[model samples]
Target: MNIPNLLSTMRLILSPTIIWLFLRDQTLMGYIIFGLAALTDILDGFIARKYNVRTKLGTVLDPLADKVLALSVLFTLAMKEIIPYWIPGILAVKEMIMVAGGLFLWNKGVVIPANIFGKVATASTYAAVLGSYVDRTIGLYGLILTVALSIVALFSYGRIFFKEKV
Candidate 1:
């Protein structure tokens, strides 16, 4: 297993730990788990490039893990009302659209690479979620950053999709 892929796998493994800790009302511990998980995300990409050990499985697993984690965090936030109810609704729509695009591309044998915008969006989201978990002091800024990144990421992704396969 490549180092980057290994780090991604660890993030996947930590997702459940974060959920468990958060559900148990252990906010501080949950933040710790989330921090470590987020760190793994940062390390994975770095190691992937530095060691030049990228793989197809990593391509698939990494995004799926991100979606899973995002959904989990969003669910918790919605329940806590830290985010508006429609936030999840819109996010779900976005994910579904992306998944459909990915499936279409995969079926056509076009290996649509993971764009950097998507990575920025994911990192921003994790930061916002973790910020909310820790304290609302920085959470507002985190959310602001997340919204900016998501807009750029999704817009860029849409541009690529429309340009290449539309």
Candidate 2:
């Protein structure tokens, strides 16, 4: 695997570990590990784009890794009563729709790259997860922003999918 792909795979693997740490009441450890995993997401994308080493696997795996990590963290936080359950619930449903749409587009030989809105949403989500460790209010606001941006991203993706599919 290329460096970018490897990084994405590492994030995917680290996700469950982060969740485990959070579940075990290891917030500090979980936060540190989660930060590292989030860094991989940024690094992998940068490497892939800058080096022009983007692959179909990287294209798919990168976002998949982000989704898994973000969703898992949100779910874990909710389960721990650190965040509202509806936050993760809404995000889970949104992600499921995104995955299904992405799969359909992939079958049709169309690959839609992540847009700015989606990037911001993912970043905000990471911030929210991190902020939750510090202050619940900050986390709540961050998640609210994430949900809004994610909805915009979903619409943007849907627009692109239709435009390309047609």
Question: Which candidate comes out best when scored by TM-score?
Answer: 2
Q: What lDDT score is found at residue 14 in candidate 1?
A: 80
Model 2: number of backbone collisions: 0
**Every candidate's CA RMSD:** 2.0, 0.7
In angstroms, what RMSD does candidate 1 have relative to the true structure? 2.0
Q: TM-score for every candidate vs. truth? A: 0.87, 0.98
lDDT of each: 0.76, 0.93
Report clash pairs, candidate 2. Answer: none
Residues 40-156, model 2: lDDT tens digits:
999999999899999999889999999999999999999999998999999999999999999999999888888898999999999988998899999999999899989999999
lDDT, model 2, position 45: 91
- lDDT, candidate 2, residue 106? 95
What does the lDDT come to for candidate 2? 0.93
Highest lDDT scorer: 2
